[model samples]
Target: MQARLDQELARKGELIHRWSEGSLHEVDLIEEDYFTMLAALNRKVSSLRESIASLEGTPPPRVAPEELLANWTAGSLHQRRAILKRYLHSITVHPPLPSSQFDRAPLVKTRLAPHWKTAAEVTA
Candidate 1:
């Protein structure tokens, strides 16, 4: 990413140099492209910094799947729902097929949190 950012910055610099030399045409288009690339690189760098900071900081608490499952099974509906909300990004419900009965396994698509994935892998 840093290499890509450097290459893009160089290209932007070249564009400016060409403009200064009066050899480049389509000033408006070039300027727009330059600003767009700059903004995108800025966002990428900021996100990268945030990711680095998060990884460098203390790790999150690790939970065993069995313990978590036990808690989930013991919890009330509201508590279970809260746990799901905490660990899952989204749960999409698809419509049943014409010939099919209500089967939740195929009807629901769940996206889980990244940390939960890591925890599961560690336990595995």
Candidate 2:
């Protein structure tokens, strides 16, 4: 869409230049068409710029941890899944260690999104 608009604008500019130099055959007709085409091209470029601005605007605000945990505890399955998908990169589960070591061993590990970096990591 942007490329087409640029091409049309370039063509209109060339026509205007030719009309100014008295090279276009129909001066009055070409003048009217040139201005009309220029207006339409300007409108299209403005609309495209607005569309791009909307897309480039700030992203959705991050969910707070306390609110997120509360939602996870009380939300429906779908809601919980959505939160997990948005914030967590992966989860790894490990088999239980032998009885003697099980108490001290970790069973699951989680990788949260980069935006959720800890205070220590942030300070470093």
Q: Candidate 1 overall Cα lDDT vs. reference?
A: 0.51
Give the TM-scores of the predictions, in the order they appear: 0.35, 0.34
- Among residues 3 or more apart in sequence or in different chains, the pairs in candidate 2 whose N, CA or C atoms overlap within 3 Å are none
What is candidate 2's CA lDDT for residue 24? 71
Quantify how close model 2 is to the true structure by its C-alpha RMSD in Å. 21.4
Please provide, for model 1 over 1-124, each residue's C-alpha lDDT reduced to its tens digit, 9 standing for 90 to 100: 4465456546645654565566655555564554455445435544554454467774433445764674465444654775676575554454455655655575443322233334444323
lDDT (Cα, tens digit) per residue for candidate 2, span 2-100: 576467557645755675677775545654564556456545654654555556773323335764565455444665666566555565555566777
Deviation (Å) of 116 in candidate 2 = 8.3
Where in model 2 is the C-alpha error above 4 Å?
1-56, 104-124
